[model samples]
Target: MILSAPSKSADAPIPSFDQIPCPILVTDSAGVVQSLNQDLLLLIGSDKERWLTKSMELMFPMASRIFLHTHVWPMIFRDGQVREIRLQLLDSGGNSLPVFVNCQKTSQEGIDRFTWVLFVTIERSRFEQALLESRQRTENISTALTKSEAFIRGVFEATSEGIMVTDSDATIISVNPAFAKLTGYSQEEVIGQNARILKSDRHDADFFLATFEILQKNKIWNGEVWSQRKDGSIFLGQLSISAICDQNDVVLQYVVLCSDITERWDREQLIHQMALHDGLTGLPNRTLLMERLGQIIAKSQRDSRQIALMFLDLDGFKKVNDTLGHSIGDEVLKTVATRLSSLLRNTDTVARLGGDEFVLLLDNPENSEAMAQIGARVISIMNEPMQFDNAEAHIGVSIGIAVFKDRTSSPEALLKRADEAMYAAKAAGKNVYRFAE
Candidate 1:
């Protein structure tokens, strides 16, 4: 069949394609109809008036619509011509008419236009069906991928573990909701920022280096980390890092997962303190006192220095408790502990053995004169008057000093000798001190 254009100049007016004996249609680059030959309209059983200004896509069969858009349109735009492309068109009666078409883009009076020539055929139904099935498969796969992405995004945002994704340089690219919540930063605040913004000073360079070394070795690393909040407050967290890489084993991004463990760490510290401290006065109890005495005795033997263990018992303390109740007696014991701690060096240890009884360990006490002077100072402080909630009270103490110069005596034996000397002090006078012979 032949397709021709209309007159271009006044002297040689060309005949229009309507007089041609072929089915042809013309359109703009955007697929909007410009004109069509009568034979073409007749072949599709449609009138020119009804089809003139509509998009060419409107004439394609429902199943072939996607193929026309995704394949035929891109082919025309890229190559500017398409040859023998199989397509389906809907007739005026709404029935499919399969045809092979050739389209070419041309310019008419400086306006871009596409001319399509179609040849209606009865064969090639199988090829059309195959194309349609392939398009359907692509659409189905796309839908499934979209749903999977939505499910994964929901879990990432909803989880309580803080999740962060960073570039290879440790610059944060994205963060989940829990990450923002944990670090007290909004996603907008942290994006493009270095992950170091959340780092606390508690970790040294070696600590971070070791962590990165673990990641390099195992491709994943997890450990305790100290992180800082947006408000500059410090917190402890359990951080896990993973190196996300491409299939070629090239590092691309890092994924970090963290959980705040500050509360748990604080509870552990409190438990440790409770195990070694007297609950009433917050001083070392018998267990910690024994440990300290053992350490001191070992040091004294190595350094050839004398260690003094002073056992002090408050004289006439029961009378105060009997008259004023145990609450006031507890206050007195706390006060005594405070006074003894204040008088000693930091290297020394003062502990509360039990009610109205305290033990002081002094290292390198110099001589027995110094030991006696310390004992007398303790007695003088204990004899001072104490005021408790509008009640004036007086108490006294008797101290026994046991000096250890050699490793002959154990901690228990030294404590026993100090206790015997304390009894001697109490027997000699109510408010005096004695030394173990």
Candidate 2:
């Protein structure tokens, strides 16, 4: 049999082809019309007789006619098939349709051995509307994603505190500029390197192990720590580390949040110093002196050691203040404080108990001789000349010493005895030291 089927007029082999939904037409080898589908009649907005009055090219423009006669028919004849051909079809409304057309040729026994047919995949009317909708949706999604990326980048760059991201091995993956400036490390020097490069050597290996163990177990850790900079300056910081993880809780990387507390800590220390010591003389005030003396008495009671308590008043201090103005007298007091500090051993406490009255905590004294020598040393240092404001000033200390054999719960009683001896020294002589009975 010839490789052809019956035409639409004689009931074609494919039933769906007979009820073709798209515009279809068949013609013989010489191009006379043999059959047409209902779609073809409706598409041209004309019935069979109207189409028969014109050649197929009369239905198309001149350029499309040349394309159909030259390229389209030869390819179908060579391949015995045409698939999904995209082309423009002219409608009776004089509007063009963007469409995909498919055609096939088969031999018919009585019709010059060939049948040519055409199909329209898309309706000529609604094609532009569908394409416009598709393009609009694509544009909306692209714009939204672009805005989201810009917002995220701005937030990452604008944060105040230092932030760092590191991998599982503690190698830094990304660090913001604040982190670089805080640690004195450049981005190039830090990236792809272990963050432990900033390790202050303050934390030992055990400390690291404990820290990571907590992070692994709890997924987070927050506390204070000592860390060093690239230049080896040690500083304190409040640090927090959180481990980033996958869905199964396998550690991916770490995010470190840190704040430099060094300046705050220094301020706290200055406040503490101001509260415990006199400002101008840099000598322990009574509050701190009493605390030290109490501890010393408690320790001496436990160890059966003797402790000395001395009260000293600067002689002729009021004369200096009255003659040279109170400012020069304050300078002389500071000079005397410094001299006493250099002469006293580290085991003792020297305090300025307001004005020119001072107290000394003599720790671990042996006997009356040890007390006498300690007493003599302090008096000699105080008797030396002190220079203040380019002028010579001389002063003497009348000191009274008392030994505490056990924990003296009564600071009042100790002070009373020391004061009594101090008055006795003033009465006995101006530059002498005496011990309390």
lDDT of each: 0.87, 0.77
lDDT of 2 by residue, 37-94 (tens): 6766666667787666356655566666687678776877788656766566687797
All candidates' TM-scores?
Answer: 0.64, 0.62
What are the per-model C-alpha RMSD values against the true structure?
12.4, 8.2
Candidate 2 error regions (>4 Å)? 1-152, 202-210, 213-217, 232-234, 247-249, 387-390, 408-417, 427-430
Evaluate model 2: give its TM-score.
Answer: 0.62
Model 1: ten consecutive residues of lowest lDDT: 1-10
Clashes, model 2? 0
In model 1, where do residues sit more than 4 Å from their true spots? Answer: 1-149, 246-250, 298-305, 406-410
Clashes of 1: 1
Q: Name the candidate that leads on lDDT.
A: 1
